[model samples]
Target: MPHTISGFSKLSKSEKIEWLLNTYFTDKDSARALVKQYWNTDDKLQKLHDEFIENTITNYYLPLGVAPNFLINKTIYTIPMAIEESSVVAAASKAAKFWLDRGGFKAEVLSTEKIGQVHFIYKGGFDKLEAFFKNVKPKLISDTASITKNMERRGGGILDIQLRNKSEDLPNYYQLHATFETLDAMGANFINTCLEQFATTFKNEALLFKDFTGDESNISIVMSILSNYVPQCLVRAEVSCKIEDLKSKDIPNPEEFAEKFKQAVSIAEVEPYRAVTHNKGIMNGIDAVVLATGNDFRAVEAGVHAYAAKDGTYSSLTHCSITDGIFKFWIVIPLALGTVGGLTSLHPLVKFSMEMLQKPTAKDLMKIVSVAGLAQNFGAVKSLTTTGIQEGHMKMHLMNILNQFEAADTEKVTLIEHFKTNIVTHSSVVEAITKIRESGNFK
Candidate 1:
């Protein structure tokens, strides 16, 4: 049968699903039922979700969990996390509690400057182009007045604009690099709007300049878009305590544990293979909170990873040090987040998540998110340097294994007890289940 169909997007939701089932499924009824099972019960809510994207099927869900006892900047918070990977929330919570009595976490917003660019190719002398940019800079700002009017009233608008020459990197290529203080919103649309206006005004003004020839005047606009590499939009989060105070059940010898932890971080700092995984652990915490709060996790991830590689070599976003008898672990990361636009007011659960954190501003949210990454890194490093990373992780993963095998309730209980004293692995769990069934001890 031919699978291609025109106007598929024009079909109604039911029709779309019917087409999909007929085209793709061997068991059409079971596939249809499974798709419907994930739909929202409320029609209005379902419609809203469907409109969020094109060809929307049922909503995909991630478990929303809360990790409590996050004492950041001397304020207590129970941070909400939306993630599917096992043990992330649990790890963050354990780290939070470990530092709760050690003066908790400290976070501060270092800066909040985002960036955008207007790219064009002009086959002309650099001197003439430089003079043209200097003359037309005011016009570029003035042309975007309408778009920046409301943002300026809110105390945030275009910060500055610069003309960058890139002839060496790419012949006849240059850029109008602009900076912005977006305040509480991620401001992608705002920045792109201003860049487009700047592009229009720059090209228009060039045509009128006597310093430009017709070819130069006809500057070809390559593109105008916001860059996701926000090095200036930075936040720092750290936790520090006396080395002697780092005592816990997991760290009987605080000195030995602290040294090993510092060495672990050091290895990641210079080794890209280890650094990638190390930063991923940090983002597991960062992305969860970013998602729960309805911010753009993809943008955040891109900016952060770029910043990690900014020093020319990909390195860890987190660091640890021991100085003056104190052990300090910290992370400096780039996060461009918003709390007043996009999904903040639209999604009910996002609103709930905002209120759960006492309604933080963008800066406040940045601080909170940085602390989460720091705490998560600390927990992971602590585990790795001490008892190893697999012990607790596999235990948390046992339930997933049990579910994959479709174990009954009583069988799960028995297996849960059995694994408490034994190591949990896929093969081990499968062997235990097989033996239990063969012994006729389970129904």
Candidate 2:
């Protein structure tokens, strides 16, 4: 069911927040039931909620406004995201909706597992360690599988393993990477746990081998580091629209928009500053999905920026172009997010938001996430080239800024709404605030 509608000017601040609050947690019994189903104790629930309140970077409760029309892989998803920018949400939603009037956005995802790195510090030769690990690859794979047994039973676990030796001048000189399929789970903690298991398994097993290092105490470094370059779960979204549906004001030939977009990317490839802004727009959509679903936005940002420079120049993560009437968009990001672990499960609304998305594998979820980014990119360029981003963005922003001064109180908001139609000018707003000040209404 759609949430009950409210005029933006009329909603109380507390009431607005109520929309984002997990409905399951609003009642003590429902929260308790949910907590018990996943958590071991009531204490854990308290800690989760406390972390959600104090630690999670809440984005001021902006609705992860829906795009209204996105049909991907026979599944219809109205993508949800929480972002403060106005045109990003507004343009994407409207543009998507317009396309939906024709056939709808067709989207797909590649896969959903993440890869983490295991670094080992040793004084020995990396070549020797590399050969040793190569011989033990089967054992290492089996050993890692044993750790994620529960996950495998549920159709997820260690999917594959690859080994590499870095000869850097470091104490613990060996590095091993294990790729695991976590299904709907994020797999960070699980992958890290497996790394620990491997560390101990190798050390104990090493003692049994003749060629093993004699220095026991020297095996002092073993840590699992999360890698952002997790092979991407790809997402693709395309909208086929009739020329009549597009406004020439937005683009003379909507079909040409795609060609222009393709050419625009060449500029991004050549210019570092434009590349930064372009990638930032992509992140704007991606980070919101990560946040709304309770994934690590910071790490996602780090990985994306790092990936942008992979070609030696900071460039856009996605590419866009229009051949004819068809517009094509694609984004490849190392989006290794889990739906059922850590903050994603701990946050009150995270689970609910996932449910709203109708549940998807982490990799498939990344596909959805990437499409939203493409939509955001298109929407961004559309506004910049058309209405100018500020006109629409500041209109919404001013409302928020204005509320900060006078809409803090319900009566004041009621006054603002009651008179919104009449108070169109800055001077009118000033006059009303002045009148309220003279009347001591703010008090």
Candidate 3:
């Protein structure tokens, strides 16, 4: 069935969402049925809902439009993100156009695997602990079956056991990062529960185990820590276009943009303070999609930030290079997400975002998330490189300002996009937009 309303702009926001719904589900019945299966909290779900609700200062998630012209792994995609930051969407859209002409970005992802650590801090020889894990992993893994019998029955349980000796830089911190194939589900509860039980074995082996993990290592053992971050997975995006395409368009200095982009990334890599915010700008495009999908945005944020500071110093997650006058961009992130779990089964908008993501596998989802971060980073770095941030950001920011002033949608967007392109002076753009607002149309 077609949308109950035709033209998208004429529909209410909820109606527009309903129209979007038509694109994904076979019918309204299917979509509505999912809501009942997922979000319906008659009694059992209500108790679960009550378990975690708090008053918070969260913003209304606005759709960040990352334009068409993106080709990933020979697949054309116009990825849409939900973000409010200025220039991020436009810049990514712009980069996509540049890449599209060059046969799009070539991408490859390894797997859709995520590691959940059940950290057991011990006051013993790190070597002894490492040897214990290496010697008894098979027994340990077999023992996992009884613990996750229910999960095993549900087709998800201990898939791999990985032991890593934490660097002496962090004392008594030997992390047991358990790899789980959470198949169509988020594995927080399953992974953490299995690890907590495994801790008892170490306690029985070495009496010091419980005490060391107890406090001296400052471990109270927080559970249900869901990880959207995985190990450093590889991702690549590249664009090759004729130099004339840029010069022919007469869109300011192209060479300058390349040089500045490199320098900005270098700066972001060197300074932790700068890297935090720079990476946050990258996440503005990423978290929006994560939010729109009802995935845990907070976990993604913490993981990305932690990954940024991984080297004892902070650095950019993306790296750039200029080869044969073709600018190439690459980024690696531990984006462990799934399309079959949590809100992917519940929310209507999550279904919409998932469609926009083009049916990403658990691995594919991480690849796309990395692309979003890199694409957004390229846009920001490009803007800062060729034109100061203001040239690219001011226009979208005006829309933010207009919305703050309660301007209507029609006048708000039109004036903002128009003034961005033709502004001679700030005073003129502001006055012209204000006058247009008074006249009820931008023209």
Error of 2 at 287 (Å): 2.1
lDDT per residue for candidate 1 within 23-140, as digits (tens), equals 9999999999999999999999999889888999788999999999999989999999999988899999999999999999999999999999999999988999999999999889
* Sort order, TM-score high to low: 1, 2, 3
RMSD, one per candidate, in order: 1.3, 10.7, 11.2
Candidate whose TM-score is highest: 1
Candidate 1 deviates by what RMSD? Answer: 1.3
| Number of the top-ranking candidate, with lDDT as the measure | 1
Off by over 4 Å in 2: 1-48, 51-67, 168-172, 212-222, 240-249, 252-259, 324-326, 343-346, 407-443
- Each model's number of backbone clashes? 0, 11, 0
Candidate 3 Cα misplacement greater than 4 A, ranges: 1-61, 64-66, 110-113, 121-137, 146-175, 183-186, 204-229, 233-256, 407-443
- Worst ten in a row by lDDT for model 2: 52-61
Tell me the whole-model lDDT of each prediction, alpha carbons only: 0.94, 0.65, 0.64
TM-score of each prediction? 0.98, 0.74, 0.70
Q: Candidate 1, which ten residues in sequence have the lowest lDDT sum?
A: 434-443
lDDT of 2 by residue, 154-253 (tens): 9877766666656555544666676777777777778788877777766666556556566732554467665767655434555545444454555676
